[model samples]
Target chain A: MTQSAGLVAEAILPTFTEAVELHKSMVFSIAWHFLRDRSRAEELSQDVFLELHRRWGSLRSAEHLVFWLRKVTGNRAIDMIRSRKVRPETSLDAAAEPTTLEQMHDSLLASYLERMVATLPEKQRLAIVMRYQEDLEPDEIARILGMNVSTVKTNIARALSLLQAKTVGRLQPNTARRLNEMPGETGK
Target chain B: MTPFEQELKRALARQQPSADFTERLFARIEEEQAAAPVRWWQRIAQWPAQTIWALAPVCVLILLTSGTMLYTQHRRAVQGEHAKQQLLLALRITSNKLQATQRQVNEVESERQPNQKDNIRRLL
Candidate 1:
């Protein structure tokens, strides 16, 4: 009995190590993007993994594990935002004019969009992050967020429209036109 | 597929945790484990429900035993206090009796001494 117990204990470390290696980036990225603070994000990521370790026995498969991590990370991020009561200043209508076309190069554009996404409401920010960053479907996001599919769809659509509005005149004409023609534009 | 989203995705790409993140987590786990080593009772609490059920009678027995011991100890204390009260009452009664006997003896001795004096006077 002792030998078997020792073996099981030894086996758990490697298994947990691999799991952490596989999912740490996703966990850390979700927290980082949501909180925009590297240290806090790392702390939250560690907490999520610790919780995952505690509840590891309940997770049935790799897919379920990924889903669980995403759900927990997103929920924790939203909780942090709510607790902080950070009223984002940048609203859809209040968004400043986009950066000049010359300044909207690849890296700059990426950073600009990131900043814009960060300025959304907590739910919309999480929705957009999950939709684009995690590449999750609306239904999957709904499942993770414990919201209706329609609500998730609405959030994603509104967020995309807002992003489009924010970036409209900043990029080249072709890029701005493409942004306007994004998937969520018709629903508005 | 919009350029804006593509940019957003690139901007928000998966970031790695701190270089020592895993090590710190492990240390935390170990520290937590060390801080709260499971006690015997806690281990019992974590046992399966059936095992806990099986131990219910033993728990009841232990509770009853301890309760009986405490009750006996309380009863003994009460009994001892009653005995102490009885002893104090007996001592008070004995003291009163001794005082009464001494007064009687003093009265008798006084009476005898006066008779002896009268007898000596008659002899003289």
Candidate 2:
């Protein structure tokens, strides 16, 4: 190629792997929570980063780039969810025994919460996952989802209400006790 | 918004990816940026010169066209002065109406003579 084209090509070849790793977790979590399939999650996550690679210059800053990745990954996950509406939710424990009451704890709570989050409506599910899993503020979630901050807060509130209603009587006393005793319970 | 949300935050905070994620992302960006074959020396050489090169032909064309336009304008201005001189000469040679024309001109000049004399007296 011409010298200019060569220059362009050289400029683009150096940062492939770093972009892949930076977005791997967020992308993978979004996909995994929506699909409940690790392999699918990994594949989708890689696809999301590959896309980010293609459009890296359009992103303004590191934080802006992360927001773009989260938005794209969330939209792709919702598309996957709707496409598979007729099929069953993929269970990670197909070969293992069902979760027993004895195994319920903080770690189990995270897992349960992940599964329960997957069961929410697309917007609510994504907003809650971003808020909780990514520790993003409501305004950040709004920016990522292209929604208003109030809308993001409402989605999170609704998702929590649904989770609270569903698990109100189902949670064992021990699980409730553990939740109450969870570290940093500043008890306001 | 509540203790439960705060607890949920604590629980979910543990889901970070394997430690190498940022390094991987930066590496990928570097790789992509590096793919272009323009050597560093070539980039340094071309940066300032490229814009000048791209605009050079257009600049030359504009200058050429403007020179041509100015020449035409100069020619038109000369032609306009020549026309005015011809008109004046024709007016001077028109003997048939010269007397009547000079009589009317003298009357108009007489009417404005007081104003011109007053202005000159003020300036002096």
> Which is the leading candidate under lDDT?
1
CA shift of A72, model 1, Å: 1.0
Taking the candidates one at a time, how many backbone clashes does each contain? Answer: 0, 40
Model 1 chain A is weakest, by summed lDDT over 10 consecutive residues, at A1-10
RMSD of each: 10.3, 14.7
Cα lDDT tens digits for candidate 1, B18-112:
88999998888788768988677656654544566788999999999999999999999999999999999999999999999999999999999
TM-score of each: 0.64, 0.55
**If you assessed candidate 1 against the hidden native complex, which CAPRI class would it receive?**
incorrect
Q: Residue A144: error of model 1 in Å?
A: 0.5
Colliding pairs, model 1: none
- Give the fraction of reference interface contacts each candidate recovers: 0.53, 0.20
lDDT of 1 by residue, A1-188 (tens): 11121233223223567778777888888887787778888989999988876665455456667778889999998887788774455655676775465456777777777777888888988988887777777888899999999998889878877777667766787767765665554221
